[model samples]
Target: MKANQPMVKVISSGKYAPSTLITNEDLERLVDTSDEWIVTRTGIKTRHRAVDETTSDMAYKAAMEAINRVNYDKDKIDLIIMATITGDQMTPATANFVQAKLGLNHEVMSFDINAACTGFVYALETAASLLQTGRFRAALVIGGEQLTKIVDYTDRNTCVLFGDGAGAMILEPSTHERNQAFFFNAARGDTNNTLTVVNHIKMDGKRVYLFAIDAMEQAIRKVLESSGLAIEDIDVIIPHQANERIIQSVSKSMGIPMDKFMLNLSEYGNTSAASIPITIAEYYDQNEVKNKKILLVAFGGGFTWGSAILQL
Candidate 1:
């Protein structure tokens, strides 16, 4: 069999959501919003809040679970790529903190990437590519965020739409044809600043909605085409849990069924970079996933969007 460019197999997966819950009813007190309105609009009922935890904390917790699930040797993880907008600090990359928490005192290639909500897809592609180089054996890919720290409670539109959590996957290069991976990551710059997170998150909801639908559709189609796989070939699609409406629109437009997409935004709202991996971890937890071909798609703040097709 021919070797693929981005070929990495998942050894284990895990996720960490803070215990604290922020329900729509709780948001009604913070801003001018109702449970019915929030649910009808975003399909989100509640989101997790990391009260005392930082992004790196959630990342470490999630990574530990993934490692322990298979009892994988910590030394095998020679590469660590974390995708997040919120880090514990400015200088030390969040991946560094996660590497420390994982107790890897040895030299490991670790770093962080911020492509916003589509970050996990970007990081997955990066790690997969790096693993193919034969320099790294196993890679820890994580998507984590503490979005609430950067959200403004006064803004009803953005405030109710984010949460805090982390998800991780342990991957290693695989020569097996079944484990071949394909990805497409691209971005359209937000010149108008349709969505921006400087001190806090600010967004034009209408513009983002329109862009998300188009971007997600493009990514899904591109990855499928590049992988030579049709929609039916995919067992499930793990889309960014940003909005149920956006997923629904993509489903309807693409002639794909809604049930084919894994959704958990009702329990955890847009976790920024963490959404896709969290959905992937939760999906694996609920189902028997083996040799399953999955498609991941996401659209984010950089006007960034990407997709990946891989087998489990």
Candidate 2:
């Protein structure tokens, strides 16, 4: 290697969950739902519960796991980006606490990003821009959502769709000719003041289904068009785990097969911003993504949607 190469490459990725494994059947006890009902509609079988774990603890655990996977000096970590709709506090940004908890006290800059379920993709876009500008060599981007905190367990329509967990990734620029410099984009719909109920996530399942399919199709097209790659060129698609129907519909509309898209929503449900990173991590564990062109598309509550095309 030379004196100083541009930061490139995902050093490692990590994920963590609570001790409790709450299955859809367990949800039947708490709400008017059945395992079959959930499985048929959303393809969710179970999700992790925090079990007294705070968002801070979960975020730190995921960060440590990512750091452990790589040998980079902690001092070189210049940025920490955290994506969460449910930050530990409504005042202090969760990234500050993460930076402090991880002993990242080199006067590094950090902040929280919120695009509801699209948070991780948004944060990753930010981290990638920092990399391109040479403003930061190594960045820690985490998507940790304690969605159970905000979920209305009494509402069967929404409650069964969420879980608690954290997923992390280490990113650095690259000079090597690998799967790099693909497509990156984000688009948003106007925030629905009428649809919102005083700062809470207002989700109408049917409405979201329509929105997810539409927004996802647009984002996917942008990634393909911006990168000048055909839809057939992508090897795997790591889309946000909003629901099974949405994933399938998008795949079909794009003229792609279902097997080309990764599935982890059945296990983790929807962890808001954590969905994308967690899905990617699960795919990594399976060793299905290597030297492959991947398209990551996401849509979330903010009505925010994004996509990133990578070859890795």
Please tell me which predicted candidate would have the highest TM-score against the true structure.
1
Which stretch of 10 consecutive residues in model 2 shows the poorest summed lDDT?
Answer: 192-201
Q: What's the number of clashes in each of the models?
A: 0, 7
Query: Per-residue lDDT tens digits of candidate 2, residues 205-273?
Result: 777788889988998888787777787888888888879988888878878899989889888898888
Q: How many clashing residue pairs, candidate 1?
A: 0
- The TM-score measured for candidate 2 stands at 0.91
lDDT of 1 by residue, 104-197 (tens): 9988999999999999999999999999998998999999999999999999999999999999999999887778898999997789999998
Q: Any residue pairs clashing in model 1, and if so which? A: none
Evaluate all candidate structures by whole-model CA lDDT and list the values in order: 0.93, 0.80
Per-model TM-score, in order, reads 0.98, 0.91
Q: What is the lDDT of candidate 1?
A: 0.93
* Ten-residue stretch with the least lDDT total in model 1: 1-10
